[model samples]
Target chain A: MSYHSAVLSGLGTYLPKQIVTNREVAERLGVSDEWIYKRTGISRRHRAAEGQATSDLAVLAGEAAFVSAGMRHVDAVIVATSTPDHISPATAPEVAARLGCAGAAAFDVGAVCSGFIYGLATATGLISAGIADSVLMIGADTFSTIVDPHDRATAIIFGDGAGAMVLRRGEATEPGALGPFDLGSGGEHSDLAAVRDGGSRHKRSTSPDHEGDYFRMNGREMYSHAVEWMTESSRKVLARTGWSLQDVDHLVAHQANARILATVAQRLGIAPDRCVISIEHTGNTVAASIPLALAHAARAARLRKNDRVLLTAFGAGLTWGSVAMTWPHLDPST
Target chain B: MSTILETATRILVDKFDASAEDVFPDAVLEDLLSDSLDWVEFAVAVGDEVGTRIRDEELTDVRTVADFVAVVEEKVGALK
Candidate 1:
């Protein structure tokens, strides 16, 4: 009887086969390569081939995570996304089916870009609440399916991908464990970025136009908010963990944008080298960004057992979050 | 200038990955598409080209290619 905190036992990621380069988008939209790369640090992105769905990507990531964790099944499964393949059925059950863990209690969580953070909190809560001994948390998105490709601003910023983590009950005193999570949101700024036309709010507009339906984002406004929220959330999480900024061995901020990540790290006085980035290859995978970045860093050996780490994200619903954890000793690939 | 029918049907087929026969020019927007997100993505793709802002208010009556085209035409005209 000693208390143990939850720890990450495994990691996995899956990217769609179809790769779209900035050059391809530039050719279509009449934009310059310099403009795309300079603005977003995105050189290319992977998109699910037509007919391939979000669940397909999630299942792959989930299976890999299970293998990495050295477990065939978990106590629970949670899928986070804004782009579920089907509206009626939750994608978690489908993911469980593919993992051969159909008996696991599964569901979906929608926090957009901060989704994985939210999923982490929920999964951690389930472990603490005694609802589960082990939980599989996944962040998967087919953001390309929702982007208005003609809009150069957003089109280059998104793609389809997924990443997952296996969380198991462990002693809170363990070196490789998840610290408390910090989360927040500003609903008032919701309009600053959103897919205005699809949700229930605009289901019945008086005018007969369809353009409101695309993702609309005020880039200038979003840029400012992203820095403010992410910095604030990260600082709060550090303080809560009683860990100084210097004590953090690795800062895995969400892969929302390379520029945003740079600004946040600079504001916190953290070395850029210590900051992890995967957006160059993934673009803004939305919900999938955090887990995807973590998976990559773990595979690359940037994250080693007992190393300190921090995760954070901001996205469409004006949602934002951060979490603190120590790097666990687990193979990223089996 | 592209015909409204051709543009709308092409967008529908391409964005939704629906068959040409599955999506007719006169099909209902909701029925022909799987969900509102699909229709919205299609509308955004089309509106981006013509520089027309097709707000949600204007999408209520769009049920067919003729309807979609008419709305786009109206918005494009308004811009003019």
Candidate 2:
């Protein structure tokens, strides 16, 4: 059987209109604005308006991706997110239906911040295996809904947004064709970042303490593990693609934090100029981080066609992954 | 100069850009390191230098540079 390459044909991102500045968060958390910026490298972030859900953001991003690809249809849709509109039915099916691609194979991929790359890997497989010729992949999250406003650690770091990409069956020689991927998980460290309640193990009602409903993260442990795992995984993908750190024109890492991005790039020997960061304005949009960063990079002209881009992410569930691809020209409207 | 204290101090200076004078035996690790990432990296560097695995739980009681030095010394001694 012949395998086809899954080429990233288009990209789009949607950030909610409500902006929350560091000053506002600092005043609420009783910290100086400079302290927040110095620690998280975030100046502002967007919050979804009331009545907005993960699926709403996903649908908008998916539509933009379709428009960017100049195609009206896709064979499958994958939504990568930790926050879904409903816990029962997956958000992808609703996202696909809303985008008018009803009945298309649609599902959700949950890997927290690493969701986008995992979704990309899944979409690539679907296309290569001849299960689908084209795929619409989206990473969306509304983390602010679950974040405890009183917790300075999480409230300041998380924002809500969505990003989507259109992938089509194409040739491996194409500039946008994705190269090899490296993915890994450490379940033992799952507690390093998670929401303790709302899941089967600890149902929301079972715990009287509402604090368990909010997201919690061991920031220090997460930082060390993130840098180590991302660096290791990035090196693996680069080796798989026969590309060196010097060959990467843009290191589009998950915008978890600016400090983490800098450390990972430093460890990988990738220069600061080669790193792509949109987190300063977007905050940590969880699963939406990478694609949103990519879209922002394209809009800023920092990412050009045929440039070698290295993508990596580490998030809750102790999940991390990396993918390499040469940037492709995208529609400006996307 | 090759004692565990001196070696640990050297690792801290190299890994965290701490001044040799500031990294005294009494200096608190929390004061010297701003965030958890710094502490984690410091622990890893110390472990690598001393040829011992430093567990996170072991660092709970470690406050000052002397405390960290003692932990490293204990682990290295166990390896011997």
Candidate 3:
């Protein structure tokens, strides 16, 4: 029997209006713009307005995708995010309700930067299992909500944004059909990128000055692990799909940082021109980055129909994943 | 046979582009590798050569080239 395939139908993204330049960040962090640029390759990034929640960004991106796909309802709404509107409830239901998909099977994927790939896997599994005909998979985050602004390492990197895709059931041979996925996690390295407290395992301190409330990353360790896993996962998925490094038209790895991207590409023996360098402007938007990069490529006319695209990401939860697929025909507005 | 120090120093020179002359037992690693990020990369390079992954905490006292080499030697000895 032929299995159902999750084919890409529509794509959309929402980046906050306010742009923060590296010069501004440099003034606060006591570093030169040239220093930050040479290291992170971020010139500027978007910042959400005060009081904007992660669910709000998700809703906007989901609505754009729903409108573009011309769907009034969907079978599932899977949001991939590290930051949620509330600690108690998942963010997907509120996003689904707001996007006029009130009854979809809604939940959140908490794999951080690798979240979009995980969401894709979840969506594809749902369609393959006949549990859903269509899925609105969103990768959204407002990392500014949790990052400490005064902290130089994180403040210069994270931005606020959301991106989404509408996936419909189709045949496996379709051009937009997603291929086999490789997902892996290393809990042993979880502390490399962690909040360290405020979760169930650690009680919330009564003091307002608690360090656990802010996101903290071990940049050195993160740099090494992300490169290691993203490259390895990409190779695994490519082998499963029977594609070579030369077959990859676009290497859309997680837009974590310029250096990490360069290192992974070098390790894979993939040419620099084959990579999608969306992190230059948006910084690292956490889970929202991969889809946002897709939209950026599509909008710039860099992505084309049936082009072999390789997606890989690694992030907190020590999670990493990769997906191999051909490019979809996205609308110009994407 | 190459000793652990010679193997580690060779990795620093070949894989990570460290100047061979600047590498010594008392040389400061920060000066040789440029920054803390480089320190981590150096650990990874040494770990790859040593056949084991180096933990970040394992290099806590590694300000000098000899200190990093000591860690690499320890990992190499364990591999036997």
Candidate 4:
């Protein structure tokens, strides 16, 4: 039996209205703006409004994706997020419901920065297995909700945003059809990037010293592992797709940092200009990084139809993944 | 002199962006390296030169260049 191919039909993204400049964070942390920029390559990031949650962003992005695709309905919804509205009742259902996708199959994927790729794989599988003809995959995270305000290391690196893609069943040979995937995780090094509390291992504390609830990252270790895993995964996917490095037209890597992207691109022999980067303004939106970068590139007309695109990401849980695709025609602004 | 030690010292100097004289055998690795990335890169560079891999756990008790050299020597010896 032949399986259907999942092709990306539309893309959309939503960044919160509250912008936090590096200078503002630097002032509070007693660091120079240049110091923060030199370290993370981030100038500013968005923080969710007081009442805005991850689902709120997801709904907006999902609706925009539907509008871009010129479709009113999808069969399933998959939200990739590290920060959910609550521990129970996954954010996908609420996001789907709000997008008028009520009664559609919905759930959440938890691969942190790599959540979008994982969600893409899950959505593709659903389409291939005939479970869904179309799926709305949203990568949304309000990392600002979990980061410590006093910790400059993380404060300078994260932002809240959401990006969505509409995938429909199509033929394998068509443009926008996802290629083979290379996915992996290193459970042993999970602590390299994580939130220590509000989980089964460590419950939320009412005590005044409940600092563990905030996100923590060992930058040096994270850099090493991120570069290693993302580079390896990108190579694996390129190899699986039977495309050489030189044949890649665009490389969209997770907006973890400028240094990591440069290292990965150098290792893969991908030219600097060929890599899509939006982190300078958006910061590291975690799971939203890949799609947001892709949409940004598309909006700028940097992406063209049939361009060979390679996507990769590394995140908490030590998760990493890569996927290859041909750029499709779409109005990214929608 | 052990070639592994010489190679390890060279890697340390390069990683720390310091001179050979500054990267003494007794120098603390954490003190010389700016961050964990430097430490990991140093280990990787040493492993590349000596044909050995350094696990993160192995570096836990290693404080000085001599400690890292000893670990490398042990791994190199085990390869023989």
- For each candidate in turn, the interface RMSD (Å) is 12.0, 2.9, 2.5, 3.1
Question: How would you encode candidate 2's per-residue C-alpha lDDT over B4-79 as one tens digit per residue?
Answer: 7887788778767788889898999888887776776677667766767676667889899999989888888988
Chain B TM-score, all predictions listed: 0.80, 0.89, 0.81, 0.88
Tens digit per residue, CA lDDT, model 1, A161-192: 99999999987767557777888988987888
- Between candidates 2 and 4, the one scoring higher on TM-score is 2
> Which sections of candidate 1 miss by over 4 Å?
A1-4, A204-209, B1-80
DockQ scores for all predicted structures = 0.02, 0.41, 0.40, 0.33
Alpha-carbon error at B30 in model 3, in Å?
1.1
Better of 1 and 3 by lDDT: 3
Candidate 3: Cα lDDT at A134 = 95
Q: For candidate 3, lDDT tens digit of each residue in A1-334?
A: 5679999888888999999999999999999999888778899999999999999889888888877776768999999998889886999998888888788799999999999999999999999999999999999999988888889879999999999999999987788899789999999988878786778877685356878888889888788788778878999998999988899999999999987887788778799998998998899999999989888888888899999999999999899999998887767233
In model 2, which regions exceed 4 Å deviation? Answer: A332-334, B1-19, B41-58, B67-80
- CAPRI-style docking class of model 4 based on DockQ: acceptable
Could you tell me how far off, in angstroms, the CA of residue A94 lies in candidate 2 after the best superposition? Answer: 0.8
lDDT by residue (tens digit), candidate 4, A186-255: 9999888888888888787635777788898988778778877888899899889899999999999999
* Model 4 chain B worst lDDT run, 10 consecutive residues: B35-44
In model 1, the Cα lDDT at residue A177 comes to 76
Full candidate order by lDDT, most accurate first: 2, 4, 3, 1
Model 2 pairs in collision: none
- Model 3 misplaced stretches (Cα beyond 4 Å): A332-334, B1-25, B42-61, B66-80
A332 Cα displacement, candidate 1 (Å)? 1.3
User: Which docking category, incorrect, acceptable, medium or high, applies to candidate 2?
Assistant: acceptable
